[model samples]
Target: MSDDSNAAGAVEHREVVVIGGGQAGLSMSWHLTARGIDHVVLERDTLAHEWRDSRWDNFTLVTPNWQCVLPGYPYSGTDPDGFMSRAEVYDWVRAYADMFGPPVREHVEVVSVTQSHGGGFDLETTAGPLRADQVVVAVGGYHVPTIPRFAEKLPHGIEQLHSAEYRNADALPDGGVLVVGTGQSGAQIAEDLHLEGRAVHLATGDAPRVARFYRGRDCVAWLQDMGHYDIPIQQQPGGLGKRENTNHYVTGRGGGRDIDLRRFATEGMSLYGRMVDIVDGTAVFEPTLTRSLDAADAVAESIKDSIDVHIARLGIDAPVEARYRPVWRPEREITELDLRAADIATVIWSVGFRTDYRWLRVGVFDGAGHPCHHRGVTDIAGLYFLGLPWLHTWGSGRFAAIARDAEHLGERIAAGAREKAAA
Candidate 1:
């Protein structure tokens, strides 16, 4: 509520400070504004930068458009079941911000956040120093791209890049491309390359795959009806550990379809087990290709089985569909791959990203550096986290459920403010 000058520079203060400007931060801003909380959203880059820059050019949201809902702004497009492309997603987020006009300061990065001696939070930002009574770290967990240390051992001639840096098949060099990882990004990028007639050598992992459509509707629709998305992380099979689980690999491209690695193998895309190391210009892999593939298929079928049960229990007149059978399997254990012999000109590491929170000089985090919170509220009275996967429910980190999480945090923040005023 005040901008004052200090020895270092000018200090702008507010009742609440929301870090990050993505859907999560914006949603939080919406709720805070609704509750008459004075706050500023600090973003390191432009609004919705991830959708505009980090995602691949051909990337489409894995979830349908209907799930892209903010606090007050819902997907108003005609095709609710269709997926939004990278550009469309960026535009939609921008539109949401424009609609609400949240007090978002774009291009302002927070360098550090710590407790101020005066019973509040102090923030050191790129623009200037700021202080707030409460802070909401809406930044999602994924920050730094994770690549194995063995990458340096690979030949310098081979072009190496993380999945985030990948744009398209044409952007890569001539000859084959080795994609290491079978997560959602890896699978989709592999399919993109394969569609472009690029020879792809995929290093598979244990990431599961789900059918895009089952029975008479999209699998997402069926899951939504079964209240799968409403399940809280605490009630999940693996409990909070489910947050580390790799997302089921499926594509919304070309109007959504199942991504069967076995089908890809049958189409001459070489698939191998997890890449262990790169030694002497050769990539070593585990001999568990069959096991990895089978595991993925098993997960896909398990999801289908759940859907069947849900249908039968509801007595819904859904059309019966045949179960999935393996169309192809690896003939032998191909454990080693010579980069030179395979003519792999590029190596795309689609492994995943790690959360970076070194700047947050707070004691609220666990030994693993993960923030300890009940929902978004931390043990520290005014410190909080938002937009993290499985923070409360399966949809906590996603657009489908961020509004609810933000609303909850907003109420908590408002209550805290009222209590302070009373005291």
Candidate 2:
């Protein structure tokens, strides 16, 4: 045991230390505790910091409540189909932390994580220093927000907020808001603005969407029943496995709101393809607005088709939803948005996030600066990662997936420990 860090120099040693207090770290803590591993969790903020602050006010879990299966603490709620609000999620996470009582050091920011001269790993935190025999990096992928270089070229009048920073429509100034990258964050933010009756433009891409409810069932339930989430990364269909990760257009609000760009277009929202460049004062966009819309439509329709076919084959009488066609939208490519003329005051960059491993002084990172680990185990002994997207299966980042992945990694850590003792 060691004392808490102070302003002065202080160093604490542990058998294992997990970085991040989100679902990943907490899961690791649970398994480690079960294995009697003398480990501590170092949290940068409160438990699930991103869920605590980074998410929007109206945010809800993209996955349904049933899938929120924490180790030894699964959701026993009656309404498994219902989505939990952001506040509810934060409280749930806090309660889960309290239940098992993971030795968590809160408000402790790890400035650097590197190999120690003696052995194992050394972490320099805001408090002081922490030494550990084994290190588990459980930080989720969305550590850094991705922004384009052309953003600098935009005029001073346009206020900017990354998806991480966006809270609600009330925060924005009283002009139109342009949302770039219509992924989950972008679509949700745009929906917020749209519902508020604020003029909004959605910069889109080849975004894919799945119906919230399919065949008289929750869309997630159908997928679970179909074993869609269990599909391995290599076995993913339609070359989905080839991509590192795709920002699928899924929303938790609006009763499983179908986030179609065309629907937004019909509802007085401007739908534009990718923001290509900001030349002079005008924001130029890609000429693939139709192509993006078609891609989104294809995903929506394909999911429905699969469900209809499956239910029919199983002889399960399920209600089918009417297929949605393209709504009224601009026929020509909306390649430019004159920020001044269009009264666009704010630009919410909801494109995506990048992994930041600069502080981690290890050779485990790939060229893209992502941790190079198979399923969670790194090449280096006593080093592992968790909460990464598609680390094992399509469900790798989800609630249930985290617990399973953590258990696997936790057993591996224990085996390594046993081997070390024998050596």
Which regions of candidate 2 are displaced past 4 Å? 1-11, 117-119, 237-243
Per-residue lDDT tens digits of candidate 2, residues 32-130?
A: 999998899988788886787898898888888889988888987877777888988888888899899999989998999899877689889998778
Q: Considering every candidate listed, which one attains the maximal lDDT?
A: 1
Q: How many clashing residue pairs, candidate 2?
A: 0
Counted clashes in each candidate structure: 0, 0
Candidate 1 Cα errors over 4 Å, as ranges: 3-10
lDDT of 1 by residue, 54-84 (tens): 9898999889999888999989999999999
lDDT of 2: 0.83
Q: Name the 10 consecutive residues with the lowest summed lDDT in model 2.
A: 1-10
TM-score of each: 0.98, 0.94
Q: Native-vs-model 1 lDDT? A: 0.91
Give the worst 10-residue stretch by lDDT in candidate 1. Answer: 1-10
